[model samples]
Target: MEQEANKKRKIIHIDMDAFYASVEQRDHPEYRGKPVIVGGSPNSRGVVATASYEARKFGVRSAMSSRRAVQLCPDGIFVYPRFDVYKDVSRHIREIFSRYTDLIEPLSLDEAYLDVSVDKQGIGSAIEIARLIKQAIKDELRLTASAGVSINKFVAKIASDMNKPDGLTFIGPSQITGFMEQLPVEKFHGVGKVTAEKMKKMGLHTGADLKRLSENEIKQYFGKPGAFYYRIVRGIDEREVQPHRETKSAGAEDTFPVDLTEIETLNKELERIGALVATRLKRHNLKGRTITLKIKYSDFKQITRNQSLPFATDDLEVIVKTAQQLLAAVDHEEKAIRLLGISLSNFGEVIAIHGNSTQLSLFD
Candidate 1:
């Protein structure tokens, strides 16, 4: 019965095209069709939040440095992000989604996944539901959106990105295998650049190549995530569309422009990151008992250390001091640090009560 229910699940992934840049273009007629880059100034240490399609042609991308974006597209127009306006637009689109289904899980301000298996409008066809949602956004919001329809979230997400600015793609179960088999390994979800390169070196350039490996072989090569790849490559993803998902961890990390070898500079960076985490925890009215410090060397080697506190806290001092302690225990003098991160986890509500005790450990 559970298997039957899973077979009937209908999912849709909706993604706005160049959300920030599109909004800018829509609001100002002069910016339309021009290369608009929304982020901090090129002279500053800011990253590109979003780039218009015109700018994308010049190789500008999100998370890329604003200075690099300018170097790529010298004619690009840079504008500071107006998050207030973007949030308003996000709310409006979510309202539009509510008319069709209440089981909507927003990934960010620009994208979301909707389970339309049991839509409020009594719509039985998932494809039709997606079409209606996209058309509604076009009519009411005067903005275009791309959508993907499938039996599960993974396929739906990949399908949505198949076509560009305004696209609606539906992948039935029968079509899933062929679609996935031909897909480049790098295009698979969770396969980062490093993982993709590893796959290629192992002669697993595409899903078809990955399918040749047994589950045990994949597990031997990739660890726990290999189990996930094993299933997804065979068109099997049992994960559900969770609408009210709670964040299990809150943290911040920064990739420094230059590698730092000194402990003092590293501590200052950790302090800044710890404070950011504390502020987020307070804003969410949540306290965490575990503090984790993550470090990545210039050579891309990474390590994490975690410590559990006697009491849940959102205190900046506690977070900073705890992270600093964790940092002190690690042997950082051997390698220059390229990135540092601090995260608070094991939230108050979910953490196991240990009779008020603190535990500290080093994790490799």
Candidate 2:
């Protein structure tokens, strides 16, 4: 019965191509077709948020240092992020999505998962719905988007990235099993660099290789997440397109241009970060019971320390004080710290407003 119901489901994952960079290009005609890198200036310690396809050809990628991106694509143009404009554009895009189905789960400002199994327009065909959505984005927004249509979210998301800008891919129930078998293990969405390396070392290079292991054996080797791998490798994902997903946590952090050694300096930074988190929590009417401090050393090693309160609170003073205590408890007196962060989690019961999901959501 479950298998039959799964076959009847129609899922679509839509991802805007190099979203930040593409928006920059659309607004600035001069940047069109050029290698546009959006984030901080190359001279700063900031990282690339997004790089145009042209820049990607030169090995530039998101989260890479802006300095490294400049080395790879000397001709690339750098632009500061215009989040306000991007958010407005994203709002318009979601409005377009609503014409088809209210079962839209936005992943970020530029991507989403839509369950069009029973569409608002009675389109009946998921492929047709995907095509129409892509056309509408291009026609109305003057921008292009890529889409993946399949029987499940995992397969649809993977299909969405199979092609580039303005591409559409459909993976039907009949094709899903073969597609999974031939897929590279690294290409599996949740498989990270370290995990992929471990899989390769074990001669588990493809989905088919992973399929050889029993569920218990995979768990023995990979721990808790191995269970997820065991199921997805066989193309069985039961995750839903939740339109009103809860906001699990909220926090803010910054990467400094130079490492700091002084505790005072770290505390001041924490004050700033804590204030940001408090403001975000207040904006969303949420108070958390756990406060966590994240520290990354100059050498890139990272660790987190968390403390839980008896009562949830979003007060800036409380957040700052707790973070400072966590810092002091750690042995960071001699270590040069490159990054510091604060986050509030374990909210007793709080739901983010629709369409305002966290950027860290796996479905996004």
Candidate 3:
């Protein structure tokens, strides 16, 4: 019974190397080990979505303007993204993951987490399983991937990124604190740009420095996020790996390919944004009680217009209609439009059981 209870829980994070470009190179044998860029067309005011290591050496990167990428490396090969093909490959990967455990939570097509505490294969060791998974991808897909094995998702994610392109790393529970001590504050999960800057300003540059501060002290300055920071600094995270629900608020905003001064262009852009919000809500089966319209002007100034609703419904029509009204209320003259977005929040889960509440609105 002691041995049964002592069975170590294992989790692995797998990240496909330069996923889009790698997929492209796989389908075309001639492109192997060569620089490849996958995204929109350069002629269509496109940007590089993913660049293989070869293209990366040439200064190509994701979200960089294709025009600039071409200037950076004229010899770089550019190919459009094939989402269908990527999805098919992803399906193959998920099949392999299912052989491990059902507690798989996919972050994206290229990354996912596997919980092996109750693995189907009875592979008692997580590291060995991770190594085998990596090998399987190489053999079956003719592609290289990397993995990180740890007890938790956050550290597992960090480990996977420690080494790239067919690399693997592990962090045992006893080594967690030391692993964090060497970790830079910027590398902490959930600590993004704004927080990193504040930490630096406070002279808290590394996990070791952050560990020196008490939770209360950090909370005194950063409020709720400060509390989160304190826990992560000490290499203590209570959050569990959740499955079946991609729990969190989500929204999409796009910076225009170019600035638009015309009201016609602006109106069209708003409609495009409205359509996007509708699609996401439909996919998540979540209805939100709040709608936010974010705008950025050519001068770099930004504004957000928000509306709260009496009820939450995952109805695209409702969100789109609210977004349209919000757009009509904004001032779009004099300055050109740089970006537009629509966000829906005050999210609540959808329950098919009639015993459950419909249009839940606890936050509202």
Candidate 4:
């Protein structure tokens, strides 16, 4: 039953292999094939953001303390992150991806999904497009990427990682069942630490074992996420290759030097943030349907109030007024506020009220 549906799905997941570490090697030819670490200094309270495979062989991993990594690989070259350069590289890569398909969903600065059903390069076969994209990235940016070609996002994502550094793996329709049978349940998306442990206890350690449980049984064990596990294990995924959506909400946050006990001081700060938000709205030509006020206390507890207006408005006065009213309705009581932030959103839809202000979305 499921085999028929698997034949119809086409999805591609692209990931930059050791993105940050590889970038460091690309710029400096001397670092190629040598251990390279990109993150904080070993002296400071720094963490290892990424390490090259050479460094990995020495047991250096991301989020590991630089001190520990240094102890593991005494010769590892540590370098700070160049986010600006990485962002430029990201833009160049995305530009290459856009040439292939509009159904590009960027996962991060260096990874994305390209649905090549209607490829712009006019290559009907997705595998061909994947080859072209990898060549383009290598030729243009001098970087390596791994791609997973399959019938759905889950399988495609895992397939991409099958080969490391510069890799291209395809999971054809014919390979679906056997692939799932061998796939570890812990590796199934959304089944992380806690779920994996629970699944092991439930005698469901592999996708094949998961396939034995009914949807209701799975849901009974895993609650909300179990249904997803059941469907994905059967080679079923209905998700589209979502495009790079726009930033729906805009807001700013600030932490106070001292907690505020008085309402006037808090309101004053809110007024400033509101004015800033109003100017931003005018700049972007966007109106928000929901005005949200977020407040944090000294005790580390926080709360937010969201008031939905009849229609979205870009008016500064409206945003400020609504924010103030919402703040009043919350539990300010005698509690002191340590942090505050203001946000506005219409779920990515920018309501353009005036003609002069040209509104644009990130998708554009």
- How far residue 293's Cα lies from its native spot in candidate 4, in Å, is 16
Writing each residue's lDDT as its tens digit, candidate 2 over 206-313 gives 999999999999999998999999989878888889998777899988778799988899998887677567645644557799999999998888999999999887
lDDT of 3 at 263: 66
Please write out the lDDT profile of model 1 over residues 221-288, one tens digit for every residue: 99888998988888888889889877789887888879998889988787657655653453344678
Q: Which stretches of candidate 3 lie over 4 Å from their true place?
A: 1-8, 252-291, 295-303, 306-328, 331-364
TM-score of 2: 0.77
- What is the number of backbone collisions in each predicted candidate, taken in the order shown? 0, 0, 0, 0
Q: What stretches of model 4 exceed 4 Å from their correct place? A: 1-6, 246-364
Name the regions of candidate 1 deviating beyond 4 angstroms.
1-5, 250-291, 296-302, 305-329, 333-364
TM-score of every model?
0.79, 0.77, 0.73, 0.68
Per-residue accuracy of model 3 over 1-364 as CA lDDT, tens digit each: 3222222557799999998899999899888878898764566444566799999998898767677788887888888666557767887988887877888887767788888877788988889989988888989988888999887777889999989989999988878879898798899887876578888999988988888888888888777988877766665654455567464665767787688787667766665555455434433445678999888898989999999999876554566568778877877668887888889888776423222232111101
**TM-score for candidate 4:** 0.68
The candidate that wins on TM-score is 1
Score residue 266 of candidate 2 by CA lDDT: 90
Model 4 accuracy (lDDT, Cα) = 0.78
Please list the C-alpha lDDT of all candidates, in the order they appear.
0.82, 0.85, 0.75, 0.78
Clashing pairs in 2: none
